[model samples]
Target chain A: MSSALHTVSATDTLAGRVLHDTGVAVAECYQCGKCSAGCPLADEMDITPSQILRMLQLEMPELDDEVLRSHTIWLCLTCEMCYARCPKEIDLPKVMDSLRAESLRRKVAHPKARDIIAFHKSFLDSIRTCGRLYEILLIVAYKVRTRHLLQDLLMAPKLFVRGKLNPIPELIRGRSHMARIFQRAQRKDG
Target chain B: MTMKMGFYPGCSLKGSSREFNESLCAVMDKLGVELEEVPDWNCCGATAAHNLNHALSLSLPARILALAEGAGMQEIAVPCSACYSRLVMTRHELQENEALKAEIADIIEMDLALNAVPINVIQALDRALEGASLESLVVAPLAYKVACYYGCLMVRPPKVLRFDQPEDPMTMDRMMERVGAEPIDWAFKVECCGAGFSVSRTDLVAKLCKPIVTDAVKRGAEALIVACPMCQSNLDMRRCAIKGMSEAEAHIPVLYITQAIGLALGIDRKDLGLQRHLVKVALPRRAVVGA
Candidate 1:
């Protein structure tokens, strides 16, 4: 049985990349299910937090693809509940962050993650345009991208009446500085 | 002589949750604590940055801290817990990893000493209230029962934040007590309120926040007190969706810790931006004393 068993190297698997990117060792996860048990969104996830780690631990390419394409990565709110409760001190949120990035890079993100990704992109675009977040701009961009124009139409006028919705973007004098920061970060990551 | 401290309001304070910023400033002013807004501050990149590019996440917050440091500000009060988490985590990460620190410095085109420490609303209030009893400052004590909601970012990943007990934090509860508000020991005090998904996944947020609101109301909490702007928006703005998820109606008003303190200090409701809430701040008028 010992001779028939094959050992997979840590440096050559999805877990290795996760470890390299997030410094979270998936191999250290012992499938205790403690993370899944504590996760607030475990039931909603396509795969539980511990299962994501388990897939990485298995060192299988197909399992890795499934993990990346799973809605679990995008659905994660990154509340850090799993990490906070994990006995092994595994940083599951960091792992989720890395996995989401990888999923986006590989174009294997789940179809259900479109709205979530659209919102994130719109949020970043608003920041890149204005030095700070412009709520109206973010909402407009998100609505345009998702084409969910009528989703929150009622909330706008109410917010406007309450002075919660600012009509104009609050531009910072260091707008160019903000743009350069985004440019540099994208260049480095790209 | 008024004590001066740097303030980083982030985006929410400028827009959707302006009430939080107004109330926070009001409370601080009453305590003779003058807040100096950080000059030319930018966004902290929030959930979008970290979820997509790790480099950008560190760079955005590093730039904010570097700007604060250059302005000679030693400590900054970050009222938004999401921004607070990002700034504090960036400082911790950069301090531990020299290579990443240098990279972030290069990206932001600023020095990376990380001298400016980020303190959440609770910590800032604690500092402002030091050596003085909160009861002494309360002109009108709040007589209603409240559930002090800490929510995720304020006190989670306990290793990094190191603010209070992660699971059952009592800092906010104690502050509520000082203002004569009865804080009930309820579950979901530190639960996640579907943080950034308030916009993109409103349905999910409603599903997640329902239990929190339900528990608070079921436990006889007259209101839910929060320190994070995201939690306030999720619990307040998404009340309709939460209502749709259940047959029972839960209309408990979500109050920011600063707003609650401001009320206790007899600050004007309009000045505190109390009228901006989606669910009306209709805590029983009978609870107001000496008004």
Candidate 2:
């Protein structure tokens, strides 16, 4: 059970905005810790998935970005174990994703999991350029950004010898169409 | 039923997991189906797009589905579990929310077709060979004990996937049984192997994948079978790299379901891309009956 901190009010739009965008009602969660119990990476999170929802239930602030900056949001595997075990059928993964989107959009500080953000940015950049992910190029770019050049050095030669790494990325004919979609999505979001 | 399916190999299949693509093609050929490649398919946006922008994630997969429908494909088979999850989730979201669908339609510059249902390789093969003769195709019975690792993306978010039992999925188990391999009951079948974090958080991935690899081996599983390239990469390629596990202790061979099937069909190991694996693959010896 969560300690009493604040009371829920009608004007709290964080819960409403979440419900509007993702259809997940934060008020429905009873802080059973069922989600935390089932979460595989719960041990690594600064705040458990259940606790994150509890914050919204209390309506801490509309744009506090405190929960968004928590390592819990980035550490989530999006494996949906918590989502599967939720009695309220609350999609924790979706909620976490929404928080991550908000975190990125607001340019809030992601204290932990900076490597994940770098990898994600590199991955999307790869797709945006080639219209498809080029693993070899994506890895190099990620390595450069994260300064993890030495982690998987041993596996590179093996991957290449096995015909896994290609020198050039295959460009899809739908590249321009995909670029258009990216542009529209950005404009709409902005 | 001479079923033809449009195949969306995703980027992984084309890049790192070429063996998955090769084995799938060989197995499907034996199962009697033509896997027409979806032409001009873009990335499925995977975990990256969804976290940054909601519409880009849905629109990316929607574009691929729309292309499959345009190619006259009623069913699309995706071998990568991440891609499968993205595609199915996109459809689920679009179907449930009409406003989102309309917005996505405008962004992609096309109508979002709720049709062209996506199926993973396991389901696709099971459906194709449902009434066909499977015993005759088995030249090599995969007699060794194996663990079918579904990981999270394949079966989780069960409401949207609607493909198998979330906690205890038996599609791979049943399929492996049909092919003469004993599928072991393991705890991490639907567990997460730290997907997408493989590159970003190697230590975290190693930590997560350690138990999965150790438990399967501890249970006497000769090989840990997987459907997702990420799982295979994490478990197989990064087996020795895991923080806690030693080289000898964590040396179980991780295989794609298609490669395992190709072996049972007695397809040459070379054709199945067995040699591509990092942990040297060694199949158990067959017991001769008339010795």
Q: Show model 1 residue runs off by greater than 4 Å.
A: A1-12, B244-249, B287-291
Candidate 1 CAPRI level: high
True contacts kept of 1: 0.85
Off by over 4 Å in 2: A1-12, A62-64, B1-3, B246-248, B288-291
Docking class of predicted structure 2:
medium
Query: In model 1, what is the error at residue B219, expressed in angstroms?
Result: 0.8
lDDT of 1 by residue, B107-203 (tens): 9899878889999998899889888889998888898899999999988889999989998999999999989899999999988899999999998
> DockQ (Cα-based) per candidate?
0.81, 0.76
- Write one digit per residue (lDDT tens) for candidate 1, span A57-147: 8889899899999999998898989888888898999989988888888899999999999999999999899889999989999999999
Interface RMSDs of the predictions, in order, are: 0.7, 0.9
Which has the greatest TM-score?
1
What lDDT score goes with residue B109 in model 2? 89
Which pairs of residues collide in model 1? none
TM-score of chain A of 1: 0.92
Candidate 2 lDDT by residue in tens digits, B245-270: 65545667888999998998888899
Residue-level error in angstroms, candidate 1, position A91 = 0.7
